[model samples]
Target: MLYSKQKVAKAVLVLIFFTVVLIGITLVSLNNGRNGTRSLRSFVSEDTSTSPESIDEALQYFIYGAKYLLAAVKSTVSDNSANITAVSHSITVVKDRMQMLLSEFEHHLHRTEILSFLSLPVINNHNFSYIYNREDICSKKAVKLVFVVPSAPGNVEKRQTVRKGSRGDYVRKNANNTILLFFLGKPSPGSNYLSLQTKIDEEVKEFGDIIQADFEDVYSNNRLKSVSMLRWISTYCSTAKFVIRADDDVNITTVEVVSALERAAETLSNFIIGHKLIADRPSRNVKNKYYLSKKEYPPPTFPPYLLGGLLVYPVSTAKLLYQAALRVKPIWLEDVYITGICATKVYIPILSDPGVVFQHRKS
Candidate 1:
């Protein structure tokens, strides 16, 4: 079946046109997968007036594009004979852009809502030096107990006195198994306070067990101080088995704390052990120092929380509580906010222990 030359030429031209169209469609699909459906609009709206709805729509498109690109990159990387270097470069660029977009979205949400807690920046310039930072404390031995003592700036002398009088034997006995750190805030700023600063410096030089952050030394900032201390532990002493968040003034029986941790070591990975308060209502009296406004806490009954003066928890529980605190608004009561609310947010259990008593005692 021989055909004329002109007819054969016409058929070849038609085939070429169809092939071009198919290639064009393939390119468009790939571009869409990389930049989403609103890719064109995103570029156009860059210089044009846009509304919130339009920005939201663009965000959705960008998210879709990111997901699609991620899948494509993963698939491409799995192929053994693919151009690995080129694919990796492309993926890095896409990841940077996606991260930038997500950051912008978070900023927008912060502006529109009361999410100040979520925006709390990481504590910077924790001014206190590491007086007794044993980086290998957990690595070298089994750390059964870690006592985090929250102390005031004015209580340095008292702390030293107590350490020498009452805690000396306990410290000596648990030298390898326990760690003790005094948490403090920055000193008051004034010329008259120079002597106090010098005293603190001398004490730190002698003991080297204080952890000071840049926050104010006040009752209301206790929650912040607690969280900051947890952050420090998470950064520096993450391998410890258990922790006791306590006050410098509290009479902590180190023997009791070590025994409890030893007994519960197998079953207590995410539990808080302390004197628990159940079904306690928030105070409403304006004259009371522990007053709670409805705006601050609308819940009728407070979740069961350990007494702030002395609470024991596994290191894992402390880490989870710290993470949840970063996302939740802090209440004035550090015990309720951190152990009850934040722990609840992260699904950590709070258990009552009769041994951890909170009372002032005369040495």
Candidate 2:
């Protein structure tokens, strides 16, 4: 947040007002001592008639008042100097904070230009290959929409939950127009790898909806999973009018998504929509889970991005974004790298459809 100019001005004015009040009190006290009166009111009300002795006493009072006035002025000046020094320090702190905010704002405002100029990782078609693919799923069927979910090999229960929920029901009801498939990579090699792969093979045999690629399915390789999905869709499901990239944990209202797409059939190509995050600054704290080092992304703020939980875009846009990703370096954050950086490269706008996507919470 920017430091408020009005607040600073008001504070300075208040300090000055208090300084003047202190000076007035000092002068009043000096006057009361000179007249030997309890208060200024009593001194003013005393008799003015004077003899020669009284005149001499009045002259003495003037000399004392002058001396006391000078002393009081000096003390007030000293106090005010200290106050001015404190105010200067405060202003310096506020200035530094404001500069940081402005610097971040500048990065956000011009992110597209910066992303375009930065060097990115380049790759060829062989960067990823499919270990298990079902090209026949889209080749034989006239698919209007496809839902590609990136799943970890160990998340067998989550996959089953999706198959049992509305997503499964929607595909079952409209198999001709819709296709739902889970995208996965090899699980981390461990003692349980064989057991997990065996179960995955069984699920593939039973469901015929899982697509496995030749990459390690670790947290850092999430971007690889998404890029693989894009390449698969563009290669096999190009006829699909719309594609929804969803996380395994999200609960999608497939009915609403279909209805919305049907209503916008005339303008469904080369566009994307989902939950959008705008002008989000990259986390710099090393302890943060989403931290981005300056060496990785020098910019203070990331480009506008859609959340990875749910995203809806035309297959045409997905193809363009995939092409863009081939040249752009992948970031640690998959959502920011794919939807934010790659989408920006291709000039696709990331919008919001709150009613269509919801984060699923176990009740």
Candidate 3:
């Protein structure tokens, strides 16, 4: 008879529990026997004048207790062996069923051509007209790093000044190997935001390193921003060895980031490095800004994700993650959607490091 997956899973858990209990019991019993034997030897040695009958009685008691304990353990082992066999069979059935289901899912995805978005049309407002397109670095010379900074439209001048004052020297020193691009979205329509837009346009023309995608600049649209950034990177700056996605407020020097990247260069491919959040649950309070409704995400716990404020990935990993994002349904939480769910699909390893701090600091 076929067993349901739930039943099979329960049986496997039972088998594991029994195995642990059996091992624990065996260890405890062995320790007790050793202590008992030591005590008996000590008693005999200390009481040299003790009668043989007394010693024999004590030995008999010990042996009898040991025999009873051993018999009980043997019975348990026998019963557990039968249970383990049955549980193993159930596990095998479950594994087969899971494999069949996975195959069917893959077939369905292929039939729907869900993974065939290699030629996705560039979103309307995604054209990088005034980009600081460094053709020289994009060619035969290897670009070592690319910094993708997500910035608010209003913070253009402040961010630019901070970048120049703090990280300008480092950028110039590694001019051949490093590039930094600030990503932004259009300000909300109908607001008195034309001045902010004009300022952003002026900066873009002056610096030529800002990428403004077609999307609303809001907290809820960060996931879309992240996806748009990744798609842009995959298309234009795919040759860079490492990519660091960070926020404008983060106070990290280019030197420090490049030093870390250089240290991990040998084994960086398909690896994401950042502070990791493990087993984080969705906030339930409706009033909380981060609250996720049951309809938005039904899972009790989220998969491990890197903090959104700062993340480092090998260029190849960035490409794969972007492709994965195209296939996975996006969640509003950019970090969870792009780095957690999409990264999991591609089996990219997310490594936690304390070096990348996300907290805001004055430059």
lDDT tens digits, residue span 116-170, model 2: 6434656534367777899888889689889888899988999999888887887
Q: Of models 1 and 2, which has the larger TM-score?
A: 2
Off by over 4 Å in 1: 1-144, 165-168, 190-192
Residue-wise C-alpha lDDT for candidate 1, range 67-170, written one tens digit per residue: 56556555554545434443555544444433333333333323323234435664333344443344554577666667788887778766775576434456
Q: How accurate is candidate 2 locally (lDDT)?
A: 0.69
Task: State each candidate's clash count.
Answer: 2, 0, 1
Per-candidate TM-score against the hidden true structure? 0.60, 0.65, 0.62
Output the better candidate (1/3) by TM-score: 3
Q: What are the Cα lDDT values of the candidates?
A: 0.63, 0.69, 0.63
C-alpha lDDT (0 to 100) for residue 343 of candidate 1: 74
